[model samples]
Structure formats: structure tokens, C-alpha cells
Target: MQRGGRVDGATLANLAGRDGGSGWGLKAVRDVHQGHRLITLPSGCHLTYGANDDPRLLALIDKVPSELWGAKLALQLIAQRLQGGESQFASYIAELPKGFPGIPMFFPRTALDMIDYPPCSQQVKKRCKWLYEFSTDVLAKLPGSPEDPFGGVAVDINALGWALAAVSSRAFRTRGPTHPAAMLPLIDMANHTFSPNAEVLPLEGGGGAVGLFARRAIAEGEPLLLSYGKLSNDFLFMDYGFIVEDNPYDTVQLRFDVNLLQAGALVSNVSDALGAPLDLAPRTWQLQLLAELGLVGPAANPELNIGGGGPGAEVLDGRLLAAARVMVARAESEVAGRGVERLCAVDRPLGRDNELAALRTVGGVLAFALSNFVTTLEQDKALLVGQAVAVPQPGGAGERQLQPPASEDEMLAVRFRLEKKKILSRALQRVGALSQAAAGNAELKQTAGSAAAKKGSKPSPATSKGFGSKKP
Candidate 1:
């Protein structure tokens, strides 16, 4: 490699091997201070390009088969490659010997050419088409490098990893201080949370010393929790479909008594408020984020709307989720004078006796309900997205036919799980607002039409009193 001109003492600290000479066992890393940010990547890579000029990197690619590729999977695979892999992936990194004459490390373009498939495979061909599409102009200008497959250089490990996964993937940068090539080793050891520990202090010079700070006061045997990312309740739900029971990240965070459920609800609300729910389609998301954003209606408050819908919806990344949650918490603060109740009316229903009981119940299960509600909210919102499988209302009108028609055969499709009956099915979303319909359909006020209005009749003055349009 180039005469060791990396961070101070990084090379002296460890050989350019994956082990980094410290074989520190994975106990999970947590940040000790709040507002601590460890800069992971300074920038992204050019598609199919790497810093390496080594002919050996390219030589290795000649040995790899370029035939194996799946086009539909190719997009996801490329995204995965960009994000990199888990910390444990260092094992694979360590396997590559340093000072090798050819293929010093995993190469970028080499990895693309290494697809192990037959020449005629449609997937492989599709990926090739994707590369061409990218190279041409689909996503801005792409570079064209038709170098000899045999003598191309090894792709940078980070670039290859990024190709494997996008920078946004949760597993992208989860690795601890395994190699200097990664974020300053010990710095990564401090995990990330939406609310992070103070791991960074301003230094006299330019760069700050990245340290692992404590999120809370430590007692012996407590598993320190470093924030992973600004994971939203909706994103989390989309990811795991419920509160993280088996998640290695959050479960370990719980040792510090971090309440994920409470955080999740706040995430859901703020994401909703920001007019960014799950953007299923790229078109819909572009409209929301890049075009008209926020819940308030357009220009003169003319068109009413809800945020975040469609198939292939874009989820709120961790950074935005974390900040939005803070906004939600502050907005709901009674002292802040906004007068927004933290819970929906149905969640804490009215009535003297019921209210008292509800208070006790809320007090008793605040933590439990927080997680449960966020989980339910996520599932419900996913339904509203309704892009993947959209069918216009089927069956006779008002005859109780399923919306977005589903066949008996479709419902009958069997998925054999070990505990088939134990896992609960996700609840469907209410057509407009799952929140109003959370308890039941009865609570939803039909501002547009009720049974009387549907029958060509006008509603009584009392019934139509306070209904207002929702601006988006």
C-alpha cells in the first residue's frame, strides 16, 4: 500500500489486517455521551470506480465468473453492497492476506464482474443493462470504464462493501473497531442511537478525538448501549414487523434501560407530521419530499392530504427519525403550551370511572403500550401505502366486499411457519386514518358522508357542527 499515510498512529496501531491485532470480543458498543457523532464515511464512491490502480486487483476479476447475476435482485444487491456488511464481516476481510501480488483486497468493478451465473441468465443481463443505464444518464452522469477485465485493479474494500449495501442500510456500518480502514476503530465500537452519547469533544486542531461515551451512569455488568442510528418506529416496523425481540442492537440497548417503545411512538407521530410516511413509490416520495412537504395544505390550504404512501415507499432514515422524535416530544410537552395530548382520545377514553381506570392502566403499562402502539401504528401505515398490490374496490357497493380485492386463493396461500398460529397477523389500515379507527370504526366521524347523507339526505346541524377539512 502507499507508505502508511493514514490517521495518526493507525498503521502503528495494527497491521492492515482485519483483526487489527486486538481481537476484542464483540460485547456490543455504546456511546457514553449524548450528541456524540462519529463520522463514518467522508463521502460516497463513484459507481464502478475505486482508488486502487493496482493491476493485481483487476487480475483477480479475470478468474471470477461474470455470468452469475439476477437483475431484480441486482438493484437490491447493489444497494446492499454499497452499505457494506456487519462488523463480523471483518472475518472475511481478515482472510485476505496483505502484500499479495494480485488482488490485494476486494475490488469494486471486480466484484460486479464476479457475478456467478450463466451467460444467458436474464438476471445477469439485466444487471449489465443497469450498469449501462447508470453509465448513460438515468442518475446523473456516470463514468464509462471499459478497461481490460484481466488487468484492472482491486477495488477498495470500503467501495466494494458499499456496493454490497447502500450507505443507508442498517447493517452498512455496524462493524466495530476491527480495521483502520473502517471509521476510527474504537469510535465505531460506540454504537449510535437517535439519542447518542457524547463521544466527541472539540479539539484545538481540526478533527475531534472520537471516543465511546456512556449513555447513562454505569453499574457493573450492564450492557452499554451505543445508539445505532435514527431508526424510526415505522422503519423499524417495516424492518422487523414488531418491537425488536431478537434484535442484537436494541436488546442490548435495553440493558441501559432505554425505552424503545416510547421512542417508537414519537418517531411515528413526527414522521407523520413531517408529511413523510413510507413513500412506497419513488414518484410519490419525490412529490412529498422534493415538491410539496408538510401536513398543511398547498398554497391557500385548498387540497387536503395525508403524507407518505404508495408502493416502494421511501422510509424516513435514522437521522431524520431521531430529530423528528425530538420535535414530537417537545411539541407534546404541556409546558410548551401546544396542548397536544400524547395519547389519542380513544387510548385514554373519557368518563370519570373509565378515566380513572385508564390513568391506572396507563401508569401500569406506559412502557408496554408505548411499544405496542408504535408497532400497531407501523403495520397500519404500511397498509395505507397500498402501492404494491392495489385493486379498485371490488364486489357490489356497500355490500361489504373487500377493498383492493383479494381472491380466496390469495388468502389461502399458505406460509408454513414453525409456530404458525402463534404469530399474530398485522392489522389492516383504516381507509383514511388508522388513528381514528384504532379502537374501532365507530369512533371515526364521517365528515363527508354518514348513512343519512349517503341516502341523499342532509345531516342535522348538531352532527355537522365542528367537522373541518385536514390540510396536507
Candidate 2:
């Protein structure tokens, strides 16, 4: 071990051999710490869990209404499956109708996911860093963990959510795109302390792995802390519920991990099924669909079952995040159209043939798509960052590649690749939106065509290009 001490658990069973720790990268944990992790035995190194690890964690998981033993078992299986290799089991349990009990009072998020933690307090981030340092410093001084079959990080969460907080996350192994260096479940468990005490930034490569660090002085017994990364200001707001920012502001961290993306898809399906019959317009329904899709809220995330189905690929396929792009563009188009219509209503002149003019149609499809697609571009770029960090697929998987590893050399590589991908995907996304533009043009043609169809009718040859791209 290090030099200071180690803490062992005395309660419940030690599921994962009552070992030091049992998430993904157990090897790294050992290598990094040299066997002196300083923490106690968790009854088991579960890949995922149901409600709690043991009865002591809270009242009783057995008593909880849901049948979750199966899931808990699955978590253990994933751990065993990926044991010695880089694999993590991400899971959760949310029974509280409102919110669970407090988390700080328990083991801390050091073992959970970051998105699960509070809004990521500035102080927590600082304190968490100090705690991690403390954990390392105490390595030698502490005694070996008590050999309790049921003693591990699994059962510390209290009846009130305060005892422990778990963050849902994607699995990472050293071999995959989410290498151990980049995906630190250990750090992830700690959550975002916000004080900058601990940070895990991408390594020197333009798109390589990440580097974990301590932001402050550490103690001898405190838990090691980590971050969830910078998020958009609205964070997961657009996914979970209805909270839109007047002015777009970004959070220092990303709101959801790849896990949320999956959850959102499920939620959207459910919400649309239930809410679709309410007789709402597509736009109104589309906004509601965002929450179902997990773009709005925090709790919308689901428990990640290891081996059940790994975090879906990072949506590198422009098509995967396409609907989001289309929706955002459409919204923007609507607004722009309104403005144009105001101008048009004032009897603006369009005296020439084959000439472009503003539209009077307020909710024209093309205008909406343009706006929606424009907003989605930022989300797409941001998501690209997440996708870049996601599991890599084959080169032939799609039209583009994830930005190459984030390296100094790779940055240029990434820049070039990104430029090409942007051109391709943007053009693709734009072309996809063109259907709406076609509709808008047709509306104009109908109005203008009516005039032309009557007299001096030389049907203006339909143009294939956009008003924006035309050489004025």
C-alpha cells in the first residue's frame, strides 16, 4: 500500500472477496495504489445492484416492493465477467416518490455516478479532492479491512438517500474506447466536488484518454473524489423536464453520461405513448417528447445493467442524433418565418421572377427545420465530445469517425477530421431539413405561381439551392 492506513468494513458480506475495491479497472486501482487503497471490504464488488447492498444500507431491500434481486445478481455477474479486465457495472435504485434521503451522510458518491449527485457543489468538489488525497496518505497507517463477508462499499447508503449516492454510468475497460485512463469509476463514484480539488481531463492527445488529478491538499482517511466533467448550464434539463434557458449558458460539466442518452430514449417512448392522444400539436408534443427522451431531467436516468446491454455507442452516426437536430432547426425556422412573415405582410416587393423572397407562412415546415437544426448543431458538437469519449466502432460503421484521440498531434488530426465530418454531416443534416425548405418554397410558389399561372406565366424554373447559398 501507500504509507498511512487502510479502513475495513465490519458489516455485511464481502461479495467480491472482501477485497480492496471491485468496480472496473481493479487492476489500475491496485497498480495506482500499490495494494494500499486504504478502503474497507464491500460485501461484494457488484457490477450493479437493486435497491441496496444489504439491510443495513437502509431498512430492507427485500421489503422494498420491487423484485430486484435478479438485477443485483446481474451486477455481480458483470463484475465477474469483466474481472481482471476493464469493465464496470453501472446500476441504481430509486424508490422515493420525490427524492431519496441525503447522500453526503453516507459513503459519498466516490463509488457512485456523477450525474446522480447534487447540482455538483463548488465546495463538494474541493472537499472531495482533499478526501482522495487523505485516502492515499492513510494507506500504510491503516489496518487491513475486517474480513466480513458482508462488509463492503455496497451497504453504506442510508434509509435516507444521504448515506450514499450512486451515479449511473457507461462501462469502461482499458482495451475499449473508454480506456481505464479515461473512464475512472473510482473517481466517478466520488461525483463532482466543484472546488476543483479533483479533476479528470482528457490527456495531451487531441482525443486520447484522460488524466486524473487532485486539486488540493489531501488527508489520511477521507475518500478520494472525482468529477462528472463540465456540463451545459441547463445540463440535462432539456431531457428530463421543462426548463429552458432564455440565453444559452453552458454548465462546466456535461449533464448526462451515455447512460442518460439510453434512458431518455426509453422515457420518450413511454411519454409519447401516454401523451400522444392528448390532442397536442406536433411542436407541443415534440417539446414534451424531449423529457421522455431524457433531455430534461436528472432522475430520468435508468439503472445500467451490466451485460444487459452496454451503453449504446456514442451516436457517432449523424442519424442517431438527427431527430434532435431536426427538431431544433424546425423550432428556429418557425421563429424566423414569423419575422419574415411580418415583413411580408407589410407588402414587401418581390417584383421579379426566379427571385427569392421572404415568406408569409408563419409555421412553414422549412423555416422550423432550419431553426431546429441550427440549435441542434451545438448539441451535436457537444455530444460529439461525449461520443469521442464513447466506445469506438469500426471505421466503416458510419460516414465519419469519432474525432481522433485528443492529442497535440491528434488535435490537428481531429480538426481535419472534424472539418470533413462537419461538412458531410452538416450538409446531410441540412439536406434532410431541405424537405421543409422545399415546402416553404412550394408555399411561396403557390402564392407566386398563382400570379404567374394567370398571366406572363413563365413558371420560374425551380431552383435546387438554398437562399443562403445562392450567389447574391
For each candidate, what is the lDDT? 0.25, 0.27
| Steric overlap count per candidate | 47, 110
- Cα deviation in Å at residue 81, candidate 1? 12
TM-score of each: 0.29, 0.22
Off by over 4 Å in 1: 1-166, 169-184, 189-205, 215-223, 233-472
Alpha-carbon shift of residue 303 in model 1 (angstroms): 13
* Strongest candidate by TM-score: 1
After best superposition, candidate 2 residue 58: deviation in angstroms? 32
| Model 2 stretches with alpha carbons more than 4 Å out | 1-186, 190-198, 201-211, 214-472
